[model samples]
Target: MRTGQQPSGHGFGSPGAAPRATNQNTVLGRAMGKVLAYIALTKPRVIELLLVATIPAMLMADRGNVDLWLVLSTLFGGWMGAASANSLNCVVDADIDKVMKRTAKRPLAREAVPTRNALVFGLALGLASFAWLWWRANLLAGVLVVITIAFYVLIYTMVLKRRTWQNVVWGGAAGCMPVLVGWAAVTGSLSWEPFVLFLIIFFWTPPHTWALAMRYKEDYKAAGVPMLPVIATEEHVTKQILFYSWAMVVTSLILVPAAGLVYAIVALLAGAWFLLLAHQLYRGVRGGAEVKPLKLFLQSNNYLSVLFVGLAIDSVLGLQTISEMFS
Candidate 1:
């Protein structure tokens, strides 16, 4: 009936052996290592990217007149849900992580954490997240949290990821859910504003991810993942990247009706800049030059962050949407 085993030689053990006293420094170091290992399982950087788009969506939903407590709760709940999904993904991808140099240092891949522990931790966090969001935000937000986690884990990680080059295109749906979760947290309902925000991320995900995948093509190949850069020609993949980049830019414009002048200006200007780099990368691919895709990858992150920050600022500034200005 033992769910888990105690550390060996704790109390009951071999004959006549005295229990070893725990060294405080060693204990602290071990505890700290466990903390970091668990943190790695959550992939904090990716969660940060997901969360970057969240609060702004909340601000936009409520028009900057948000409850501080609600915002805090939503942010925390978003982090929890993302953390759960990431942890479960780490566990699922442990085999591939061991093969891919980019992921080899992950805690599970490195054997710093047991798979069972990570699975239990991930599941526990998911249940806790649902309860927290339901109590702190609303039932709608709570339901969205569960749906996102399930989609990310079951669809993206398990089904679509290794099966096709278009995996990110569809699987990225889960990543686009946070804005919905955020908007739902604020209004307890749905609208076009949040859907516009969702599309922005939906189209943004492929290019941002494909850019990184291009850099790690070998890693994906070695790990048997069918990422676009792994199975397709550089020209073909970069072409798709350019296509998605422009698609994302066009989607950003759709938000102008809801987001207003500040966001529109940033969207037009930043979207142009983002496309410039996307085209530049495409050009490098068409020619024989080194594309250095990570540049575009980094820029895409900045582009999304800038757009959302602009939206938050616009809401705070009480800027009117183009639709409103016309009316």
Candidate 2:
């Protein structure tokens, strides 16, 4: 309507207004970014690996006749427990995370979340995890969940991580607690079988973590963390990895008496494959050949995933039926 105005279509009131769209987009993007940052604080991949080991433990404990609702509830509590520990670990290592290239993008490291807020969030999840498991699973399961969170937050993150090269070796004990939690959730008791499952992961951690550390040696060195690869010769570190790899394979086999034939055969084959990969990495490093340590690292993930899947399949087949095949 103005003398020189041909159209008012581009004005603020118009549907096509650029400023309004941009402002909305900016607000939405920031909100989604914050949500993702909070999720990242929980270290989702590690939690996924924890669950892979957990469900199988439960399945075996209950002879594949587990109540689905119980399984779901136990999984939720276990996830919360793991997430709480990881979030708190992030808080404790925020300063070190900023120094490590591998961990620099984490929430506290990048200041996406306030340290106090992250700490509170972690504590809240821990309490919620305990309450949920106690109500839905059992007291023993809840107690185990809390113990793991405490160990991971106080012992591993605070005490061992920066102080020693054996950090992952021993710190990983906290990660193994989920198997026991899963077993207790189903049976309302702990047993040698679940303890054996716990040791498989306990031995598995060092090789898995150290392999990744080999690739990020500089990151740990710069962060002043004493990861084995950062402080030791490749020869020494590779030997250590092999030591743990052997322990992992042997511990996996130790489950055969409880799990029976199908799991035994799968564990034997999978353990062999895992050991092969582990040896290749060591031998390559030993002989001055180019090696991809992360190759072993990635396969280690696959190996554990497969091993647990085999356990689930064995449970489904019924341990007695599977054992009958060999008789």
Candidate 3:
């Protein structure tokens, strides 16, 4: 029942007997607890997808000869930047999160992290991320990340989330920036390639997020967040999902000309599979079948994972195809 203590009284045994050991363990535990609370603010699972999108773009930017040091540094900066934005969001939305099942256990929502402390932590992380990226990568990469944090925290979280049903659609621009950041980190400039990747993610976000909103529609309603599923009928939401799914698929194939036959083939196959799943979700919702939005939500994860992984693989192995097309 004691905070950070073993049930059998591991750190609590006769305080004066093993004072040194007890003090050390207690300090270590508290330090770790603080670290974890901060990490939770960043929403690690969301950052994983961002990194997944980021790394492949770096590889493709460098044609598979990406600098490992650059990748590691960019990832670190990206994590800090993302953590900063998510933390600020939690701080601002603490009240809303407290009422929602999905976000109620967040550090700020649960009052585990003080509002003032969380605000400082988020701001510090944002500043550090910019400095780290600028020092380790390129100025463009650093600036792009700053823009990402601004869009997510100021534009999306503060301005749009509670105000519009189209929040996720517009707000997803922040999430799509990782590819730009990663590409700029390597190439020090923007190109059509990274833009295509950005479009792919932009189109993909609606279905990805709306499916989740559907699963937690009531929670969003309770929180007063105007997510699509909360404001629109199930059929309308699904139709929008299908629309974005197809748009995402189409944008994904634009890389074919640049990425060559291997990437082209993988994109086609993956896009087809993703579209099929979207259609299935639409049909299920339309027919009033006992379908769970989580079904589509889970599939969206796999769809993205497969597509991003395929991109990485093609970047390394698609040289022959690239050479053949260009030769």
Candidate 4:
């Protein structure tokens, strides 16, 4: 065999050895990076907040013994729908997201995931959510879920997000739908109590999100997004925040009689704390002080979580004294 010729290496040191090992490793790394990027597109933090609105509604509807199956189903469906909406938002805002530091690393903006792939993923999740909700929960709940998804994906993200300063004001209604969905899953119909909870979240969204927007005003301005702080003067934004903060407090307190003394006490304390923070932000904005709105933003999130948790607890406790008042 040609004098037992040494096998010729194809750009490698050994015969039959795999070539381009470095390139192969790079390709593997890139694939793994893309997978992680796709996960990030789901917006886990927003999903968590959405769950916050959902769980309390379920507990309140059940009045104590929440159906484990229903809870699980609602959670799965809500998460799927929320993730789908977030992905759609990313696709829609990819261009502007590239200009914002907070959103610059998003998968679509970073080109880690193809736009068509993201769109497909969102649609798949949304369809799965609808099917799950319809089969496991009431049709009303499923319908509400669909509406919530459409409101966020179409009305808020596509139509309003970049078009006006009041985007969050009106878009907030979309975020409040989880409460209605959860309540409908139990009752299979709409009622006043869940609507009250919806209103609480509707009013709460502004101050909670605006504080964050205030902190990121520069990024939003650079991206040409007309977020409240970007479009309105700081003083005006602060006033708006204060107004919504007061409204949230009032709405939350209304649930006291409709819910219970425990809920009332919790709402009172939480609402006071929320108002204090809002007042501080108002002062900071008025004085043109460089106060960190991030503090208020984070605290607002905690405040809402605690308030809702308290409501769930009160509902489970079932204070007859408080229930009779509504009767």
Candidates in descending TM-score order:
2, 1, 3, 4
Q: What would the per-residue lDDT of candidate 1 be over residues 32-133, giving only the tens digit for each residue?
A: 999999999999999977668888898998885867899898889889999999999998999999999999999999999999999999999899999999
What tens-digit string does per-residue lDDT give for candidate 3 at 1-327?
Answer: 778864553445654558788789999998998889888988888888777899999989888575789889999999999999888988889999999998989998888778999999999999999999999998999999999999999999999999999899999999999999999999899999999999998998899999999999999999999999988899999999999999999998877777856677788898898898888888998899977888788888888888887888888664755546677
The 10 consecutive residues of candidate 4 with the worst lDDT sum are: 10-19
Task: Give the number of the best model, judged by TM-score.
Answer: 2
Give model 3's TM-score versus the native structure. Answer: 0.91
Off by over 4 Å in 3: 1-29, 318-327
Q: Which candidate is the best by lDDT?
A: 2
lDDT, each prediction: 0.90, 0.91, 0.88, 0.86
lDDT of 1: 0.90
Q: Which stretches in model 2 have alpha-carbon errors above 4 Å?
A: 1-16, 319-327
1-327: candidate 2 lDDT, tens digit per residue: 879866667765676687778999999999999999999999999898777988999999988575789989999999999999999999999999999888989999999999999999999999999999999999999999999999988999999999998889889999899899999999999989999999999999999999999999999999999999988899889899889999999999888877767788889999999989988888998999999999989999999999999998888767574445566
Clashing pairs in 2: none
- Each model's number of backbone clashes? 0, 0, 0, 0
